[model samples]
Target: MKDHETLGERLAEQGISRRAFLKFCTALASLMALPPERAAAMANALARSQRPSVIWLSFQECTGCTESLTRSYTPTLESLIFDMISLDYHHTLQAASGFAAEKSREDAMKNFYGKYLLVVDGSIPINGGGVYSTIAGRTNLDLLQETAKGAAAIIAVGTCSSFGGIPNARPNPTGAVAVSDIVRDKPIVNISGCPPIPAVITGVLAHYLTFGTLPDLDDLNRPRSYYGTTIHDRCYRRPFYDQGKFAKTFDDEGARNGWCLFELGCKGPTTHNACATTKWNGGTSFPIESGHGCLGCSEPHFWDAGGFYTPLSAPVVNIEAATLGAAIAGAGVAVAMSSLDRNKIRRAQQAHEKLTVKEL
Candidate 1:
């Protein structure tokens, strides 16, 4: 593959039409929350831009992130966008091994220095001189530092690489730490999820390619477009929550009726992610839609956030008092609105009577 060829040229060689490419760009723009008018701009930028060099590093992870990305539907636009990038090095996906693989990585680093993108998917173990994980006789710590030195930016692709994940959970024996905990010099974007949504990964990349800058990030360094709202706020069962109808157990009548799962230990109220919208497996359903409560996998230290089946209000000592306070507040708002509506109706009736007398 010629490095000089633009992405559009490569897609053309693959028999993809210009119209298809533009459509893909439009979908990406919508996914990234970009304006409809920006689709043409995105298409132009992507068409003219050179394929960026990406070095994907995996550490203490289960490869679930990779699985999620590769299995993102079949021949989907997001997957195509991912393929457009020049992925120079990835341990699991690359065919080369041993010294040959290491050489490939070194060559890419030297050739694309200051232009490559470093994508990391797991936590780096800091214990015992970082002996827990190694590649080509070098620890993940050494490789990340060495690789990030010349890259334009770093994308922490999973909860592990973003927040230390399960490896860094309570009683963490490996002393795992996220990439941000170590590499403070480069711009880092966290796509935090147990295994982040595939479209989200592609959307962030598309944004960077189009705008030549990283997307706006939240306090946790995650993209705000996707993680801006909590799962509870967007959940289909929200009306049930407001009506105070909850499923006490998984097999109860309320559960069958699709009521709120808060009492059943759903972390949706506190978890921020795009699962409820983008969903998984070709937009079929998320965990919550599949009759399971959210585990808050996208949040940092979720594994240590108490039981997955425990409600947020369970651990709080003032559960009754807090519930009462919330109910009273809601009631007060409802009453105020009702009073305003009544006053408007009474004034309208009085105006009609005055108009009748004036007419007479």
Candidate 2:
């Protein structure tokens, strides 16, 4: 691949028409919550921009984040957009290994020093001089410090990299720490999901390519467009929750009726992510839609947030007074509805018995 070629040129070579590229840019603009008018601007910027070098560093992780990105529907615009980036070094994706792989990373750092983007997945262990994980005999801590020094920006790609994930959960034997916990100087964007939404990962990259800066982030350093609201607020079952209908058991009538799963230990009320909206597996359905309550995988310390089946009323933190009041009111309404439903059933049974006696 020619290093000097613009993204537009590269896309043209791949037979991707200009119209398709523009459409892709428009989608990206909408994804980022930018105004419709900015789509053209984004298109122009990306067309002219050079493919920036990206060095991906993996540490103590399951490679699920990598799977999410690569398995994002093939031939889709998002996949194409990812392809446009000059991914210089990725442990899993690159063919080179041993000293050759390390050399590739070093070369990219040297070539694009102070210009490259560093993407990280997985937590760095600090216990025992970072002996928990290493690459080519160098500790993850050493590699991260060395690689991060010259990058223009960093993107922490999953819950592991952003918030230490399961490794940093309670009884964290590895003494795992997030990238932000270690690299304080760089402008880091946290895409915090168990394995984050793939489109979200690409969206962040597109934003940088278009606007030449990181997207505005929330207090947790997460892109506000993706992590601005709690899943419960946007869930389809939200109305059921407000109306006080809840599923007590997975096979109960309430479950069959598609009632809210709040009583079934859904962490959606406290979890801030786009899972309810953006969804997963080509927008098919989320955990709640599949009958399983949210595990709140995006939020920090979720692994240690108590049992996945534990009711939110028991161990959930930061329950506002208004929310508590709403829950109480909803429960009251549910009790009244239940009583009315029972009365109607009894009346129907009584009338049927009367008719049976008359026939006899």
Candidate 3:
């Protein structure tokens, strides 16, 4: 593959039809919440643009992030767009090894200079002179600083590189820190998740490729398009939650009926991500749909946010007291209120919404 070849040229050479390419761009545009009209413009921009050089660096990670991006059973648009990039240096995917692999990284840095994208996964261990993790002869800290110097922008993939993930969890043995903590001079985008949704990863890359600039980001430096709304807002079980119907146990009747899992430690109410909409496994289903609560893997310090099975906040309404009086007095209320009239139900729903808002 040549660096000067446009993405459309590459796709055409590989026998992918323009219609298929346009369909992919439309889907990507929708995922990014762009206007319908923007899809055609995006397609045109991306078709003529040269593939950007990407250097993916791995530090103290489990490789789950890489697996999430590459393990799709079929060749979807995400994989195709990923392939469109000039991945000049990737430890796991590159054919070179040992000194040759190191040389490739150096060569890319020299050739692309300040025009290459620097992608990082896993936390950087700065403890013990950053000896907990090393590549070739240099520590991750040294390498990140060196590579980040000439990067057009930095993309910290996964919670590990974004928020210091599990390696930076309790006990703090490694003194692990996120990419943002180390490289302050460059523009950084954090795509946070235990292993981010594959589409979200490609969506960010696609936005950059089409616009030649980073997308609008939230306070956490995450793409606001994907992380703008909380999972609870878009969850299918939200109606159940609003009605105060919840599952007490995994095998309970409420659970069997697809009721809300908020009481069972769902962090959807507070955690923000696109899981509820974009879903996983090619939009087949997300964790909440599989009869489980959201793990809130996208939030910072989620591992230390408390037990996964614990509720986000104490039960806002108690299940023992059963009447509008309980709701008015701000006391405990029943989970099921089938006998309530329409007006009473509306008041109860408003009460619940108010309390949940305060908690969030």
Candidate 4:
């Protein structure tokens, strides 16, 4: 693809219809929670805009983020959108290697200085002079520092890069640190997930390509559009949680009946991500849909949070009894539970008063 060619021209050359392109933009707009009318504007802007150069650097990660983005189920639309970017360097996907590959990266940095997007996956280890991870005899720390200087913005594309992920877990030997920890000067957007949803990654790119600015981010620097709501809030099993029907074991009756997985160690309540709604495998299903609870892989330090099978907190009441009561009286039981708690406090106060009177 010629660097000068607009996305529209490139798509046309590839025989991609404008209607399909518009559809993709509409999907992206919906994903980003943009107005319906904005889809057309986004499509137009993207079609006319120059493909921004992207330098993807992988460090202390499992490459799952790259896998998620490149191996998307909707390979046609998603890959096409991916191709819209002038990816100057990505060791995982690029064919060039050794000096040739290094030269390409250097050339892109020089040519698109202060304009190219820097996409980093994985944490950078700082221990032992950052020797834990290196490429081309240069430490990841050094490479990140060098590359970040001229980047227009940086997209930290996984939990590792965003928040130091598993590499920064307890007793970290590598002293892994997030990209934001090192590159403080540049604008950074954390796409924090074990491997962020493919559409989300692309949607961010689309937003940048269309508006020339990053989307509004949450406190964690994650795009609020995707990370604003907790997974439990959007999970289909939420009704089960509210009703107190929980699966005690993976193969329990409740489990088969699609009860809440909270008891089985789902971290949906505290984990903020779009996985519940966005699903995976081309919107087919996410982990919860397959019977396993959310591992809360999107959040920071998830690996060290607790045992994957351990409940976030032990249930205050027996799941079976609460489920039965809820099933019998619905919201009334909830109200009664609240009243009972107040009654218990009132009894305790009365007992305290009696003891004080006796003492007096």
* TM-score of every candidate: 0.85, 0.85, 0.85, 0.85
Candidate lDDT scores, in order, read 0.80, 0.81, 0.82, 0.82
- Model 1 earns a TM-score of 0.85
Whole-model alpha-carbon lDDT for candidate 2: 0.81
lDDT string for model 4 (307-344, tens) is 57766652233333444675588668877655543443
- Pairs in steric clash, model 3: 318-333
Better model by lDDT: candidate 2 vs candidate 3: 3
| lDDT over C-alpha atoms for residue 13 of model 4 | 86
Give candidate 1's error at residue 227 in angstroms: 0.6
lDDT of 1 by residue, 214-281 (tens): 99987678898898666775788887987889999999999999998988888776677899888888
Lowest-sum lDDT 10-residue window in model 2: 314-323
- Candidate 4 segments exceeding 4 Å error: 73-82, 314-360
**Tens-digit lDDT string for candidate 2 (1-360):** 686467888877889887887788887887777888898888889988888888999999999999888756422544443555788789998889998999989999999999999999999999999999999999999999999999999999999999999899768898999999999899999999998988788888888887789998876788978987678767899879878899999999999989999888787866778988888887888889999998878887657654567666423222234345546777676565445434433433343233234433
**Each candidate's root-mean-square deviation in Å?**
13.7, 12.9, 9.0, 10.1
Q: Rank the candidates by lDDT, best first.
A: 4, 3, 2, 1
- TM-score of the candidate numbered 3? 0.85
